[model samples]
Target: MNWLTNWIPKIRSTKSSSIPENLWHKCNKCGEMIFKQQIEDNLLVCTICDHHERMTAKQRLCAFFGSEKCFVVEEPKKYSDDPINFTDKISYKSRLKKYREICDSDDCFLIGIGSVEGKKVVALSMNFKFIGGSMGRALGNAIVYAADLAVENGIPLIIFSSSGGARMQEGMFSLVQMARTTIAIKQVKEAGLPYISVLCDPTTGGVQASFAMLGTITLAEPDALIGFAGKRVIQQTIRVELPDDFQSADFQFNNGFIDKIVHRSKMRSEIIRILDILD
Candidate 1:
């Protein structure tokens, strides 16, 4: 009996296995259970519903430009990390530190230079993981730098915007970025270079009001939320019921706010096609 008990213990120990975290993902749209690898291979889109998931700035850049062909541009070193010394339960500097560790980025915006089909292009991708991709001084500087770099290299500029609007911690500094980024986009347009804007999930607030809408060819991912204000806010303000799909990519395209609805899989080719046509 003792020998039998010892054998059973050994068998139980051998049978036990730990499942790693993040091995599976649940699609928010369709509630489909998908393997993490499968979702990533599909560019984070849901296999069943084709719902596009939010991607990190670096992920988007690598996906669009090919990791081997992309080079990151450093963010400006002079901008203040906490301009207004804001504090709400936690200091702004502390919040920045936390998100920096989480995102491994200096700010919400990331700039990179890459070759798309052998044509040089400067791209700016916003990281919504970092404080909702809030527009701030650093982001404004990065936008200006990207625009200038595209102009200098005689290349096109592309901006992928996914933001909740302006950073409230930065106060007026954040609000002013809308104007600054607008001016930067204007500079790119003046240089006669293409400035393509790709609106991703939840592009709203000051971002949509400014450069996100000022693209030479504005593009949006399927089912992306694009608008100046949220549906609830707009409805409350206007005192009218909004459409069921208000501010969706399809809705915006129908209303002529967006030029096209692009899928993540076909985005690179579509951009290349546009570049070739413009070239």
Candidate 2:
């Protein structure tokens, strides 16, 4: 009995099986715990509340074009990585490196060429994981390049926008992207090709002010926050209390700011339908 007690103590002291992190995810809207795999199986939308979760750029491309049909376009070589040599708490270059490693991306914007329901399209998706998907020289270059590629191929252009705003690190260089992207969208429209903007959660700031709102057919995920300025900023400036759902996708849709509030599951099909109609 004494020997058995000693053996039990030794076994207890040994390493125990560790539980995997991120096995379960809490739904941001409903506060329900759901299996992570289940969330992925449902296209990253919460099973309980149907709240659309943010997705990576690659995930978005795969969702729309499937793994086989999606091919990432090479980033253009014309833009400076840190255009203004800016720095804050950390050097802008260091921040870029950190995010690049964490996100496994060259920049926030990922441009791809893919086919949706047999129709070719140039797709650009923003990775909010990379510094809130802020617009800068890289993003501006990507947008212009995507637009040019779409026009050259005579294919539709699709953008999945998930951003906080322009990158403040780059100062005016970041703000210039707003105009650049807008011009890119205009070029796409001038070519008479469909330009679809899919606003995911938290599309705001300079992004919302520019190309995001210029889509020929704009669509948003349910409950997405799409606005130029933050709600708090607007409320403070106007000195009036805003509605609870002020910048929500539903609110924008109701006010005719966006074309539709689409469920995550229906987004692909809806885009395909719109493409067919445009064709």
Candidate 3:
């Protein structure tokens, strides 16, 4: 047995590298190993299973704007970094700093002006990588900025929502954004500019309750999660087991919560067509 154990080490050493690390991503839904470049070309969707992967705000913007440069709108000023002086395992200020460095973004909200298929539009997207895309005062202000920009320019506005909820560190101030953003969207509506909302995966919590659902036409990626609460929480509260597809974009579309469930491949063309028609 000792000799066999010694020989096992030698045998293992003879094998090739087992680490599946470089330029390949395993699909979370379908468990398919796909090349990174292929996934990027496919808009981060799995080729075999057609699973839509989560995208960063920057990636989503680039996809919509194509290879050309899109002018980014200046985000509104943020409140104090640690409004409540919030602290848990780590301080809120420190966490913000860390996440900013990790995500390479000032905040979760990214506002910009970009041409989509030659139609100029005002755009805002949530960066879920930054603290789960929690909506704070900065994001709320950004939404207002985008809305005002659209209203002022008489251009269409599009928002990509991929948030977990309101920023807990900001407390009530964060929750206040829900109302603020809704009001801003209402202003855009009153101005007669189209406000399109694209809900990405895991659009839930305070975000779903507000602007994420207030689009002139609500569209979601295929199989993306869209709900106010988690399945477990809802089931526990309602005292019933949830459906297999509960909170999914398909489920939402079937139930009329979502206007359409667009696949990533068709998203750009669809948006362009809709913009043309609306224009």
| Top TM-score prediction, candidate number | 1
Cα lDDT of model 3 by residue, 60-114, tens digit: 8878877437666556766667878899999999999999999889898777787
Per-residue lDDT of model 2, residues 1-279, tens digit only: 799987986776563545566799999889999999999999999888888889999888888887734675657766667878888899999999999899999888778897777888989999999999999888988899999999999999999999999999989999999999898899999999999999998899999999999999999998899999988999999999999999999899999999998888888899999999999
Q: Which residue pairs overlap in candidate 2's backbone?
A: none
Superposed model 3: Cα runs more than 4 Å off? 1-21
TM-score, one value per model: 0.94, 0.93, 0.90
lDDT of 1 by residue, 1-279 (tens): 799987988787666655566789999889889999999999999998999999999889989987744766656555868998999999999999999999998888778886878888988899899999988888888888888888888899999999999999999999998999999899899989999999999899999999999999999999999998889988989999999999999999999998999999999999999999888
Local distance difference test scores for all models: 0.90, 0.90, 0.88
Question: In candidate 1, residue 35 scores what lDDT?
Answer: 97
In model 3, the clashing pairs are: 73-112
Runs of candidate 2 exceeding 4 Å displacement = 1-19
RMSD (CA, Å), candidate 3 to true, equals 4.6
Local error of candidate 3 at residue 248 (angstroms): 0.7
* Backbone Cα, N, C clashes tallied per candidate: 0, 0, 1
Worst 10 residues of 3 by lDDT: 14-23
Worst ten in a row by lDDT for model 2: 12-21
The candidates, ranked best first by TM-score, are: 1, 2, 3
